[model samples]
Target chain A: MLPGFPHAEPLAGLAGGILIGLAAAVMLLGSGRIAGVSGIFARATGVASSSMPRLAAWAFVLGLPLGALLVMALNGPLEPRFLSLPWIAVAGLVVGVGTRLGSGCTSGHGVCGVSRLSPRSLVATLTFMATGIATVAAINALT
Target chain B: MRQRLTSEALVALVAGVLFGAGLALGGMTDPARVRGFLDLFGNWDPTLAFVMGGAVLVMAMAWLIQPRMIRPLFTDVFNLPKARDITPRLVIGAGLFGVGWGLAGLCPGPGIAALVIEPLSAAVFVATMLVGMVLVRLFEKDA
Candidate 1:
């Protein structure tokens, strides 16, 4: 277990994973769409568009915060410390562009795409995981 | 057609809600938890591995069921990615996203879900991410 955090919540984490899977299943079965959050956000925000319906994209993006709010009401808010605003802003910028250019992220490539056994998603997941680990190590080492 | 569109939007909203709620319950919305998962060389917390395992297991089953279906329930076509090539864009973009994720401990889904939990920081991240995505779009269009 990592220090400076609460005890590991494996059960909660697994339960949440199942819920996320169910959500992805719903999207795939109901709409034949990948539940890729970055892509959906881009579509909703008009940064990117293809054949996806704009209304559905908007609805999905809007619902993300509502679901989070519901969880907060039930279990109380999550206390996540962040880096300084300037640094976080820069990171966010990179994430936004990177996810767009890469064509997926945790939800899109990691969960949905990997399950489908897409080689592209697999490679992307591996790439991101490696870099994510490296970045964390670098940060811990430096500070 | 209008009725179908409405149902599609509703389904998308429900999917997003479940996805966000899962992210919260699974501790993905917590930067500490996420960072712990990434800190493989440190006092690593392996709970997120279980989370991903559980999600991937369920989604794998979904992929099996997907192929059996004639088409999606709401839409006429299944909008799935067909590209299998691992392009430089995928590797580089995923690497960049990984850096940002490690630095901020948030991805698109969690970043959006944390809007209520850490409104200011999350907003900054999301806003900058959007700008980044838009910049990519502009550059791509020019290219």
Candidate 2:
């Protein structure tokens, strides 16, 4: 456990993971779609088109915050520190372009794809994990 | 047709809410926590592994069911991605996304969920992300 934020909640993490999996399962079983956030975001924002209806995409998008709100209602406040707005913009811009080009993000590739044992998703997950670790290591060294 | 559409939207909304709540519960909505998890070389937070483990385990089970379903409940056909080959684009794009993720600890799902937590900054990040995605689309069209 790291300092400043001690008590790593593996139980919470596991429970949350189960919820995420259930969400993905619901999506796959109900709508026959991947619960890939970037894909849904793209379709919702008219950046892409697919068999999933635009209305459903928007509904999914709206529900995200509502769910967060529900959790806050039950569990109280969350303490999440964000980067400065400029840094955030840079990061977000890169994420958007990358996810679009790559055809997925963490949820799409990491959770949903890896579970399916899709070789492409496995490759994508491994690539992102390696790069993410390397990037953090570089930042840690510089800082 | 209208009823089916409504059900489809409802399913999507429920799935989205669950996804968002899971991220929040799993301690993923916090960028600092995520960054800590990424910092494998320095003070690591390994609970993220539990989150991934739980999610993947559950989703792996879901995949088993998915293969047996004739059709998803709300849709006529399943629309899962069928891409199989690994390519430069996948590797490059995933690498870029990982960098951005490490930089801000915000991927698309958590980025969107952060709307409730940090509205202004989240708005900026999300806006830039959309712009970047659109730019990629434009570039793709040109290419």
Candidate 3:
């Protein structure tokens, strides 16, 4: 039998989901911006603009690590088996290229785009997801 | 004049929480699990597909409610995009994103959410993502 209540981790995931929804909604209402990660990250890089949106984006980005710090303080540090820096760098470069080509990242298109029901977003999302599924398959085969 | 917080921000916050909770609960925050799923050719973990299915179901519900709701919490009118045709940009972007996700096993939301469990990788991913966004803004002015 599964342990009682399925495990606290799952509950934590539920809470995290609620937080994401709330953050997106709040950012839209308060700042008149979609909490799209690509847009925010774009602005933070000074490529978009240096307005309040950019400032807010910076805050949100910075807050991510801060939040993690808080969590670590409360729950103890995570023991990560760090992947090689070279692999991580390559991954980052690819993601950068993809986001630019896609017009948005998963957060922008996957979460917000799907919520808005844009056919383009839907199609784009499907493509990425299928790719992701395939890539996983391929990687496993190689390794 | 006091600047009232917009409903959008509130929405984003809630959504973010939900997203984070989902990551924590769904075991997506665990890099090892994510890597395992990406190891499709090897271990071929298929759990992520179920998670995506759950998200899609929620999205379907949102679609049903969106039209009837009429007014958005902040805007007088709900803003839907006018374009539906897929462009070259969309296809290329999706492809790139797939490559990155396949290699890294990280997407924006889950990536940011993963900070709670894996700070270093999350930080690097977010930072590099921001840089990519900036570059797009700088070079894609005509776009």
Q: Given candidate 2, what's the lDDT at residue A91?
A: 89
**What does candidate 3 score in Cα RMSD to the true structure?**
4.6
Docking class of 1: medium
lDDT of 2 by residue, A1-143 (tens): 43454758888989889988899999999999999999999999999989889999999988888778888999999888888888889989999999998899999999999999999999999998899899889989998
Quick one: best TM-score, which candidate? Answer: 2
- Report lDDT per candidate: 0.89, 0.90, 0.60
Model 1: pairs clashing at backbone N, Cα or C within 3 Å: none
Give the alpha carbon lDDT tens digit for every residue of B1-143 in model 3: 12323443334444445455554455466655566555655654545544544554455455565656656565455544456789988987887787777777776665676665766787787667656665665677776
C-alpha positional error of residue B38 in candidate 2 after TM-score superposition, expressed in Å: 0.4
For model 2, residues B1-143, the per-residue Cα lDDT tens digits are 89988999999999999999998888888888888889998888877887889889988998999889999998888999999989999999999899889999889988888799778877887898899899999998999
The prediction achieving the highest DockQ against the true structure is 2
TM-score of chain A of 1: 0.93
User: What TM-score, to 2 decimal places, does chain A of model 2 have?
Assistant: 0.94
TM-score of each: 0.96, 0.97, 0.73
Off by over 4 Å in 3: A1-35, A43-46, A49-82, A112-117, A141-143, B5-8, B75-80
Order of the predicted models by TM-score, top scorer first: 2, 1, 3
Put down candidate 3 lDDT per residue, A1-143, tens digits, no spaces: 12442322434443444444455555444344555666565656665553334444556655444545445565665544435555655667677767866877666677667776778888888888778768767765676
